[model samples]
Target: MRAGIIGLALAGAAVPVTVAAPQATTVPVPPAKAPFTFQEVMVPMRDGAKLQTVILRPTGKTGPLPILLQRTPYGVPQSAPSQVPDSYKALMKDGYIFVYQSMRGRFKSDGSFTFSTAVHPDDPKAVDEATDAYDTIDWLVKNVADNNGKVGMWGVSYPGFAAAVALADPHPALKAVSPQAAWVDYWMNDDLHRYGAMRLSYATDWLYMLQHDKAQDSTFEYDQYDTYDWFLRQTPVAKIDQDYFKGSIPMFTAMLDHSNDDAFWKKQDWLGALKKTTVPTLNVAGFWDQEDPWGSWQIYYKQEQNDPDHLNQIVAGPWNHGGWHGRGDTMGRIPIGTDSGIQFQQQIEAPFFAYWLHGKGKRPDFEARMFESGSFVWKSYKHWPPRGAVEKSLYLHVDGTVSFDRPDAGEACRSYISDPDNPVPFRPRPISPTYPIPDWRLWEFGDQRFVGGRPDVLSYKSAPLEHDLTVTGELAATLMASTSGTDSDFVVKLIDVYPDNYEQLREKPELGDYGRSLNGYQLPVAMEVRRGRFLESAEVPHALTPNKVIAWNVPLRSHDHVFKKGHRIMVQVQSSWFPVIDRNPQKFVPNIYRARPEDFVTARQRVCAGSKITLPVMAE
Candidate 1:
């Protein structure tokens, strides 16, 4: 129920003219040639450092038009140059200046770039981006003649992080910002390290790739190829040191040194700095965005609670990290069935600018919009999911059942053996040529389904559903069991099983029913995993008492889905989720970073009637 912006194309120009603009101020438009003109410009930072920027302007002479800006460490040319043919053409044709800038020391920007360097109390580089962003905005508004003296900022992933930093010291011209899939706290959310265990493959590979000295001309090609190869190899990250990871090691070391939520992580927390944001903000996240979805939600909620007048809108969709990929119509594995991407620009993004920058339309109505997965429906709410929803627990039963009612019958438990040496590989099959870094692209549906039938995995399913059920909210598992060995790991998975009779109909006419349809549907739906170790707290490692029962709570990421009548809800429990999560050696060791093969041993894992996986179920 959103209103779309309709613009009239200038007689011979590419820019679309605003109907409500003053007649005297309107510029003569030319025939549509291309959406925007691209240029490379050097933006000066507050500290005198120069950052490279890619500018995209509507293809005609127009009065100071509103600006849309994005700052990123990932090179801008990688995707910004060809935006016309890409899905963002609507935004370009509608008359807005697009600016993409490189962060300090990254790509062609002048200055040393270090990941999370700004989080360090002593790091000057972190402060540089903020001041530099403010300076750049000031300069853009004054120098760019076409600029309307108002700027709106937007970016995904690392670029989103930069956008958040820019708002910390916003320029006078900057008025609206949208940060999607942004990484707020590197330690708690990012791939490098989750809890205390090392995310070996992803961290190592990422550091190895980003380690090259960009300053050395001779190292360019070598670094690119080496980094590319490392991503394909999927090696353990903990072993990488200064020898292999040059400048990048410092960031990793810093993350390791500050395991707790000390001043280090707090400095990087954009949520803590919510008071600094004065502009209208739109935050976007995805249910499957394994990297920073939680961070995005946290930022939006914090901002909404802190600032009542500021128009803050949040959109949560069913997508992985960076899944938007500049596309306006398509999302992840599904096509929008219409020009949904263009609709988003004309209806959502464009109007947002009109209201905030141009002072034109009514303020956005809803505070948050979320796309429910499995159900595939979009829901709008004044605030986040209702706070009235109580915390209800669904207990795990002995005979492979999950129920809301606690067991009054005798207590029962199920046991499985966990061997770290023969750990469950992350994907279902062997990924011999795995990426050294944990890239979602490397592990697709095939990879995740690979571990489905392993002996170490214990699966429990509900009888074919008698009625449709929808689950929405954060999920946690409380286990009351003991380990036969000193320490062990426990893993949980939530899966949606498609009915056996369900058939995928092909939409592609050429391939007929056999040909894959671009608009095809997936039968199995979705699945998620959480890894837990008995001896270690998510923040710290504690020695496990042999044969002693202890309480452990494992939290799975948030999700929304519908189990249609006859569809099954399956819960799988295991000790290890290989490759994605590193193997716990079973023996209590001080540092898993340097564990020997001999340290791994087989241990008994139990899931009894007393132990249960609790799910937050929403009444249909």
Candidate 2:
């Protein structure tokens, strides 16, 4: 995957020179007969550190040209190759110059680099990124030929974060930007944490593998693949800390230090600083992006409300994190059944850049675009969720039922015993070579067939629908129940169940079958789990009295899906989703890292009938 090559090239310190020369990989570059000349240059930062940059200049004898820039920690190709045949070619062929720069402390650049999460200690909200980008543009406008002074910027993921930073105090030449899948809030939902619970496996593995350069003699190294395998094979839950996490990356320490959404997080948030941008933007995200989908949508909403002239647009697809990069494949156990990557990069992403960078096409018609998952079709709206969509609640009924219709009788509650010692393992399915772990960690979609029948899993389902119904927008589950322990965790899953004709298989080709032949598919669409102690507030830790029910709200992100006439809507409530989410000690503990086996206990968990899952329904 060339995963370590970029890091090694960037580190440039005296170490094992085992890495091979950079590969001649193609990255959608423009053609020779094309209107632009592609060249590599090093752009200097304000601190006199040089950043590697790739510049595409318009062909002709003239003055300076307008610039389209992207600053990424990901490497910039030493030379730009021709664009891929199957992808969109408009942006490359257009006259505007394209620029990609390696961010400070990365590839061929001088400076100490830390992931954006650690930026607060070194620089202000957008100081480093903005400075680097501004300097790059400043150099391009003067040095490049056939020039115009205008500039635009765009990127996805980390680069997307860079794009957001570029706009903090933008360059005079910067005109527009599209920061898709960009992160605004780090602690709340980016890779490190989810709903105040630390994601131990992904966080540790990512930091060790990607962030820490071995040249630094960092005291962390794991057989990335085997370490997780061994942990999963262990007998009980308590051994994981000592076995895999001890002396590793300080991930647990970072997690414990920021237990709440406090000043520490606010200082790093990019959303507030983004209002300073005075140019157009197109924010993109996927409905199921497990990493930072909320941040993407939130960025769009905040921009539109705060800066009316910013030309903000949003496009959300039925995808998981980074799903737009590749063709449709199974995410864990569920199949979304489409080439979301091609659809996004070719149709929405390409056009956005073409329009903003070259003024070459019509502005996209819809203010917001989203693809409904089960129905497998794209829909556009005047605004996010549209004006008339109403928030409706589907109460969790007793006797294993969930319905939008209110319960006509007395309050009823379903109960299960939660044992942290034998906490439910996440991604219980087999491992895949492409992923870091073997379990369904990448598959955020709910698939309950594995845990449906377990005594600890409480399942509530609705009857087969008589008509097609489309649900669009955010979903939340409000549980008005209690636990029988000092502390516990609650996991909620919303699923769509297809009829028995729906077949389940493991291989890749089986994805095509599940998409076509399924008469009904009971696939989990959205779910969330929160620690009971953090329910009241992540800042304050409150212990629960045994068997006392407390009201809790678990908000799942937005999703667009059409449940066919014969399909049923199901909601699964449980106390734990282990490995993926760390086990809640079931007792109030100072930190999960310090939790002992004796702290684990079996507690009675309940979901009362009055509790419900709320969905935003767009009236026909």
Candidate 3:
């Protein structure tokens, strides 16, 4: 789940639109079939660089409407559509002047585009995303016909980053913004690296697609259908560039150049650019968002610190990276029971923009709104994580069974030999490429039974819950472990194991012989990887002394999920998670990127008795 510093090629449904409440009695709702006239224009930035923008407005309506703008690296639609897209239907029902603009250095826009989100508001000469957004909004209100003079910005993934940066230096006309699935910190937890362990397949494929061409989205043709085999063959990620790209991709070279969280990456931290909360920001996240899981949470937390106006809000659902904009009903084969995406659009997103931009319905009464998957209900909270949530530890037992109780004093550790030659696949075999294929989107919620009984993976599962157990907020794993090698990665997953009879409750849809059913499914709720070197600090990585036990804190990020009465909670720990997270050479090197094949070796890893997972359980 990552994106190039504010770089992603989003689908049309992924396009950002304003969120508003249902039509208020005072505000007349626009007809569902409002005809829109499309016009293309070059909107000039402060530095004289003109951005290519597409403006869509109701053809004959003279009623002034707030402008809903989406700034993106992805190109805009070439022509006006005969009808409003389904994605925008819920929000557009109230009437809006939709504007889509290509960011600088993309498509027909002028100037160079760097894959970074750093905005320099102090330097007059520095023109960044914030400046471009301010300039675009400045021009739209003046030039666009019948504009209410208020503009709301939104975008998914890359465009989400663009919208978030605008909060750093917002224009007066910019009334509201929703940065959905936005990327904030690159090195820590975003697209590129997870605690310094490079994401090989994603970085290789996404960067190649992004930089191969400037005017259009490019594709990287793979020789093998199964990318796992293709990536495994290219051992030591350095070969990816040495053989295929040959340094053609600039970001790819930059990533390799700065493997550590150096000044280069720190400068790209867009979260730092947000000096104050000047705009009413709505940060949206998908619980199953594979591309950007950590970003929205960080943005929401950062804004919350100094939100005096209390304009900052957040909404999370069971969608996968802009899945809310599409069919919100189901993820993979797991039915969410309702169209959560559209529900969020109509209930939260739409009303947010409506109350702020158009003065329509009432403002959202709660600070955070999350859809609980197990209970299948929308939960509103006065404070995120809720005020009464308690912290409890679920200890990992050496006996392969987990419980709230701790392990015996004699039970010190569980051992496994992690082999780089046969690294565990992040997903099932025939792993599809991140792009061009949609399988990557649902891999977060993919059944974990594929790796069942693997020797390399240590499974610790709790018995069935007596009642529904709801876990909200941040989750982390405290692993007291040691490695035979100098360095290693600890991949920890918090899974929900369904009861054997789980299939009976769900719809019995006919499968075409090959489809897998959802019986006794092992759904990973929270999972993350922590490199041993970065345990102390992300910027400075130190090699571990062989055979010495150390604590590895693996942050599983924030989640709002429920473990039903009949379901069991499980935790699986492993050393490697394959090409998704570039394989960590068990032996430490100053730069894993520069490590040779000899540096890769099978090493015995251990999880000691003291290890436990901290869950933010909702108190009764």
Q: List per-prediction Cα lDDT, in the order shown.
A: 0.62, 0.69, 0.86
lDDT of 2 by residue, 1-620 (tens): 49799888878877666987787988896646644467877777666788778876645525444577778776775654444334324354554566778777766767756665323223553346666777787887787766677787877788887886666667777777888788877666766677777666566555554445523323344443443364444333334445755544444445555566667666667666666337777787867676667777777877777665547778877776656665554544456677666777767776776676657688765687886777776788887767767888888888788778897677668898888666665654442322333333355664567787789988888998888777887788888888888888888888888877556555666546654544444577787778777777776777888778678888887778887777899888888876666667788876655566676678889877678888888776
- Regions more than 4 Å wrong, model 3: 1-34, 505-515
Arranged by lDDT, best first: 3, 2, 1
lDDT tens readout by residue for model 3, 1-620: 46653355453236445876577578787766647888999998778888899998866656899999999887898988887788777777688999999988889999767787787867988888888898999999999988899999999999998888888888999999999999888887778887778888888888887677889988788899999899887866778888889988989988888988899999888787676687888999988888788888899999988889898998998788899898888877888888888888888888888899989889777899899877778998899868677888899988888788877778868999999999999999888888788888889999998887799999988989999888888788899999999999999999999888776543555655224667688999988899988887778888889989888888887778889998999999999898898888888788888789889999999889889999999964
Clashes of each: 27, 16, 10
Q: What is the lDDT of candidate 2?
A: 0.69
Worst 10 residues of 1 by lDDT: 215-224
Which runs in model 1 stand beyond 4 Å of their true positions? 1-34, 78-85, 117-128, 213-237, 242-249, 253-267, 325-346, 388-391, 432-439, 442-449, 504-540
Q: Looking at model 2, which ten-residue stretch has the lowest summed lDDT?
A: 431-440
RMSD in Å for all candidates: 9.6, 10.2, 10.2
Residue 175 of model 3, lDDT score:
93
For candidate 3, the C-alpha RMSD (Å) to the true structure equals: 10.2
Report model 1's TM-score to 2 decimal places. 0.81
Which digits, one per residue and each the tens of the lDDT, describe model 1 over residues 1-620?
12222323334456556766556776898755755677888877756778888887776747678888888765676333433655465455456787888777777888776675243224545455567777788888887766888998888877777776666666777898888887666656555545444555555545444545443211222233333333323222344443355445566666545544457756555545456347888887766665565667767767777675756777776566655544423444344444433445566766777778777778877777666665566666665665434566767777777766787677778788887656776553434322423445424323224456677877676677888777666666777767787767776666666565555564544645533332222222233343334235444556788778777666665556677777766677787756655667778776554456577789998877667656667766
